[model samples]
Target: MKKLINNFTYITFLGYIAFIPSGPYPISVFGIKLDILLGLVLLVLILPKITQIGKNYPSIFLISLLFYLVTTLLSVIFSEDIVFSTSKWFSMLGYILVSILAPIAIDNYSKIKFSRLFLLVVAVVISFFIIHMALSYGLDKPQRFYLGFDPTAPANYQSDSGVEDIVDPNMTAIGLTLSVIVYLPNFFDSHHTKRRKTLEILAFAIITFGAFLTLSRTAILSFSLSLVLAFTMLSISSKSIQNILTQISKLFCLLLLVMIFLFGIYTLSPSFINGFFARIENIESGKEDRTDLISDTLSIFFSDNKNILFGQGYHITNPHNEFLRNLTSSGIFSLIAFLFFLYTLYFCILKKIKGNYWRYFSALSIYIYIYS
Candidate 1:
């Protein structure tokens, strides 16, 4: 029964990830969101192991997270709209719970392998769906397609209706970014079978294209920087000159293949290339900028002394910066807690760099830092 419970917990966790792209239009059964239902079920299954969850993690890291949660809760209590704040707080709690429990669910090599494979499959399906939606809506459509039940906007776009479940393009891009980074290291390794290599290459190409379709500058930048960080760390960890040389060669080959694939897509659809470069040019020309938004958010954050200690509450405005968002919404205490958590997390990943899952975690750490 214990074994069965573990299996159920693991499968439920996988189901949660698989439906992440469908977050906007969450599937429901008898009015309960499927993802939330799965999350609750997962929590119940893993409740017995809660005490053991912290055994492997750093105490400071856990402490900082607890502090962060407490500050967030205080913010929620002080919030004007308690319902909205409570909902948001619960969502965050669920995310934290899942992260803490994941190691227990996927405790072995075989489970890890299966989880990665599941992610690859999920990425491929989402990529293809995005591609098809883009083509259907025309590449020049004002709004990009997102990962959800429907790519098009709803007829009734009410903010509170809960039916206007349009997932953000940036969110979809981030998910694809993660999927790409996860399988990217396989290209550097030499032991994979030809079929495995081919699948990885195909998945990588398709996922990359899908991310490009989102035209999210942050996602693109994060993906690029994460790859560079991963490569640099791997190079530094290399023991011999020959291994370093081989890694360099592999990197060059991989970049060449990516360029060729992207060029082929450009030849097929020049509009996508034009649109992508136009976005970059807009930033360069100051046609699109976030400096004003950042400045405005800072102004509001500092407008009141009390706001500095215990924030003005959540979702006041779109800050577009995670640290600023936390500072403005939850106060300085939450911000410090969050920063401490990340600092410890970075060291935690560094210590494990020589371990089996170093490559994935290293890339993921960079991704999280950039995204945040």
Candidate 2:
């Protein structure tokens, strides 16, 4: 019985990997791959005897979950886009599942294998994706099956960089994150294997370069945060080697920042990136719509309005941001649950792992949570 349960979990893991479409992340998976994680979560739930609750839930994860739950509920309540919010909830649930299973999946000894396979699949998928995109972009043609996002086109970036037909930076960012998480761990290689070490260096470079090409400032920021986290998680033979690694990481970050500035100057030509700057500056003005919507929705929620509390069938809500979206659809209580999920996971890493190699990932997730 134990073997069968374990087999089920592993199969679910494979299914998750196999579901990837032509790339490293889930912009596409937002459609087909959405349900698989939820399914796995449900599977675990069905056999509580097999999946220990304490091992799965941990304490820190439990706290962040509360915030997530509350945020989700509030967002749904105020979201003007109901259908969008419903779809988003699925994503939230998926992240939740990942948080629940990921720590458990790697536990003590498997972090290496899990990290390797994860990195390998991501590197392969994105490399193929970029190759496919490059061909289509170069040809200025799209075959029926070739689905791609080009930021350098008339739609996104046009003036400053002469970059049209570049892929969306966010999509690339998602793929890059997956790739980093997979390869950043030292466990994938052997102590004496020169080839593996070379691959590791090459892998990091490719992922970092690809991220630069995306020309996404926010994405770039996330990558920086993730890298610092990765470095923290890693270990070296001597203080000198560690210093070398640190210097290289700083140089990489500096170059990336320079590239982003140049790209911004080039692509946003029509408005000279000022328009870009203004748009970001405009975000503060939109809070009225958000706050007003939330305030109105709270009336329904507090008055025992079951319809609002349970969620309004998917159109009157979609709080726009992750925090707001959760509260409207799920409720304030659930919003807190979501936050608990995030913080608890952070706490788990800090509390559980005691190693030099884990510094990068440990500090990275916390940084992401901070910015998020």
Candidate 3:
């Protein structure tokens, strides 16, 4: 039984890694969307071994979530498209619940370590593809030597689902950045070999520079922030500092190599660079600022009667900002509960003497959650 659970863990983690760039669109496999994350979440939550069926949560939270769920049902009842609203509401809730529950279920360091390895493997695979994409297609269209081999977006346009949302150069760049930066916490541990450490840092630089090639203001900003937050979150013991300096030297060497790669990319493909520059012009025009979406979200939030406690059932589920998206979707009660969860996580990792990569992951995960 334990071995089965262990197998389930690896399968779920690998499935998550596979799904990230796999268009998140449901493919009709036996007439169903082959979404592994949703399936695993259901499996874990339902398996009596995964969670205690009658285990108590605070009544206050239960009552609040129940009330909000009812309100969401009301929204669906009043919605112009009942089916859309119902599906969207449940889908959004399921996502929030999974993220919370995944970490909660890891009962020990071994599980956390296993989870980190899963994410790290994903990072390496994504880094290689990002490198290939930069060299061959340069994010103009995201082609490569392997996998879905076409210099076009993976998403099939006919679906009209959000997956069909254009895989813009910046979005591709951001996806690669997620692959690298998510592993930042793994760097500090002495367990990572010198060569492995250098490779990870190199991957981060290439991914970041490739993001620059897309000229995506958000990607650039997010990478810069992810980096800054990483340094801010690091512990500065003398030995740690010395070890980090050693890693930094290797990191710099890796960056130089990527710089050479960038030069080759530019000389070989001016069109990709031109496209990147075009995105820069759009940024200056305030296109990336998302002013319209911001205005709409604020207007809806303020106009609603929901208090901090309940938040009008988080009426605006699809807010442009990720944090705001959650803020207005899960009652403020849920938001705060999650925020407290994040704070406890970050504090445990950043300040607590016993903290390790798991804690650091929790910290950065929260940061990415809010800001990404």
lDDT per residue as tens, model 3, 295-339: 666566566555233443434455556556555554454565555
Error of 1 at 371 (Å): 3.8
- Where is the poorest 10-residue window by lDDT in model 2? 138-147
Which ten residues in a row are the worst by lDDT in model 1? Answer: 154-163
* Most accurate candidate by lDDT: 1
Ranking by lDDT: 1, 3, 2
Model 2 residue 198 lDDT score: 71
Q: What is the lDDT of residue 9 in candidate 1?
A: 76
Q: Candidate 1, residue 10: CA error in Å? A: 2.0
lDDT of 2 by residue, 260-369 (tens): 76475446343424443443465446753545666666665565655445544333444444555445556555555656665666556656554544444535554562
Compared with the true structure, the alpha-carbon lDDT of candidate 2 equals 0.51
Model 3 stretches astray by more than 4 angstroms: 21-27, 36-82, 104-111, 126-156, 159-175, 205-216, 233-281, 284-289, 296-319, 323-354, 357-362, 365-369
Q: Summarize candidate 1's per-residue lDDT along 1-372 as a digit string, tens digits.
A: 978877777888888777643323456777787778888887777667678867877887788788888988888877767788888888889777877877766688667656766777787788888898888888766565766546665323434546445567777787776765665444445777899888887887888888888777777777766665666667767788887787678668867886897798789778877888778677635735677777777887798876787677755546777888889888898788878887887776666554644465445545463544
Model 2 error, position 147 (Å): 5.5
Model 2 TM-score on a 0 to 1 scale: 0.58
Give candidate 1 misplaced runs (Cα > 4 Å).
21-25, 140-142, 148-162, 184-191, 233-250, 283-289, 357-372
How do all models score by TM-score? 0.87, 0.58, 0.64
